[model samples]
Target: MDKERIIHRICALHETCPGNIVTEKEAISPELIGLNIFGEPLVGFASATDELFEAFKNSDIVGPWFLSPTEWLPEAKTVISLFFPYTEAVKSANRKATTHPAAEWLHGRIEGQAYLLKLIESLKKWFDDNDIKTCVPITDQRFEVVVAGNNFKQYSCVTADTFSSNWSERHVAYIAGLGTFGLSKGLITEKGMAGRFISIIVSKELAADPRPYTGIYDHCNRCGACVKRCPAQAISLAEGKDHNLCGAWLSKMGNLFKPRYGCGLCQTGVPCESAIPRKRRT
Candidate 1:
């Protein structure tokens, strides 16, 4: 398909997608970005790695093509960094003044996990109908998928999606325009950072990454409000991310808190997201 039609179809899929702008292939600048779905191949739940990989196949996680779980497919020409913002879910659930308990973290966020699942399913169908292959955009979910297994550590697979040099494949989606680089661990879009944000890596399809996002980093005010508010004190002023504290805290809490979710202090800035409007009010 022509790039114009492919881009047009994707934009039409999302009312807020801002439509397509510059083509990615015509000019692959040094600043050019791409999604790296090649995480730990057999990393997810049990020996079901192949089965788990198949789930994303023929899915419209982004109107797509080949999915490279451990490496980018050489055949993939176009990469679509699909983004789904969680600001609304965060605002709606996070109505308290004091911070939530560690166990109750990420509470106010992810109210729309089910909605997102449906959205991905819908998009997958659309891509399948259009004959486009899609890849799996893994996040924390992949970690648990493996951890749930009886003997996860014994396997050759990793606990999560950790790539060479890049560590946990953090920059891939961000550079791909899925969202902006955030100091609080992951990327933050207009939707505000609340919970797991999936990156839909589109391939083979002719389309363009909507611009500005292509060469931008979310200008964190550096207020460090998240650092100050974090109950675990997991955030460090010198280092950008403190994986140890974050992972340990979440593990100990273990479904004892209010909403029974992951720690949210990092992204639950009381002031940062104020700029984002409260409700859609349909």
Candidate 2:
């Protein structure tokens, strides 16, 4: 499909989609966020791991600037990263869930799972219709490839990890122009990082990645709210964060919420999100 028509179709999926923030731009972010949320396995995508799943369990192999990851993808030309600000954006913008149970991912419920898959099915049909050769996670194996080591966690590949690679989510999102970096090292979007979710789609034919939909980083330079609030002490004065600590902290908050899933420490209450001040509601 022509690029314009592809975007139009994505928009149509948004116009009549099941989830909230149905627009194409807002729907893709979670994929990247998922990439980020599970950062360990992604580094393996760059490096050739004898045990692809085990490499996902360890961050020891990750190299700086994705040198290993880049070397791994020999068949790529351009990668287009997409952003979907699902519930975080919804909450940040103070938009109510139009229906009964909330549709957000952070609540950790599988409620939105099937609806999201159908949305991606529409997207996949769009790509196939357009003749875009794509290579994201497919079937149960791709997702299992990442989280196979963890016996407790099991999610569908299509649930997220769309068009994934080894690079970190923040790096990909920054490359795509969807958001800026926060002191918490979260990708802060116009949705204030709270409401934002991220996804990635790579095309061998797209030539250049689309210019970032969010534009340049401006206010991000002045704020360190994420830094101030980080309880894990995982964040660095520079960039290196201890995911072990961050994950542990998020786990700490996970037990409190009696929701269908669990608590998302940084995702809940969301001082970092509310701090950004609301963008004018369209």
Q: Output the number of the lDDT-best candidate.
A: 1
What is the lDDT for 60 in model 1? Answer: 27
Query: What tens digits encode model 1's per-residue C-alpha lDDT throughout 1-282?
Result: 664564455445543321111124321232312211111110001111223233332222110122344343333444444444333433434434345542122322223343344444555566668776654454323332222111112111122332122112233444344445454555554545554434343444443444244333344555566777666776655654455566666666545443345556556654444232233234
Candidate 2 — number of clashing residue pairs?
20
Q: Give the per-residue lDDT digits (tens) of candidate 2, residues 1-282.
A: 344555566567755665433334333344422211110010001112223223333433222223222233344444444444444433532233221222244432332433445565677666666665444332213332232211211211111212223444454455544555544545655555553333334343443333344433332443333444455665554643445566555556455433333222333344445334333334
The numbered model that scores best in TM-score is 1
Q: Model 1 clash pairs?
A: 38-69, 38-70, 45-145, 60-124, 64-133, 65-133, 87-191, 105-262
- Looking at model 2, residue 262 earns an lDDT score of 27
Q: Candidate 1, overall lDDT?
A: 0.40
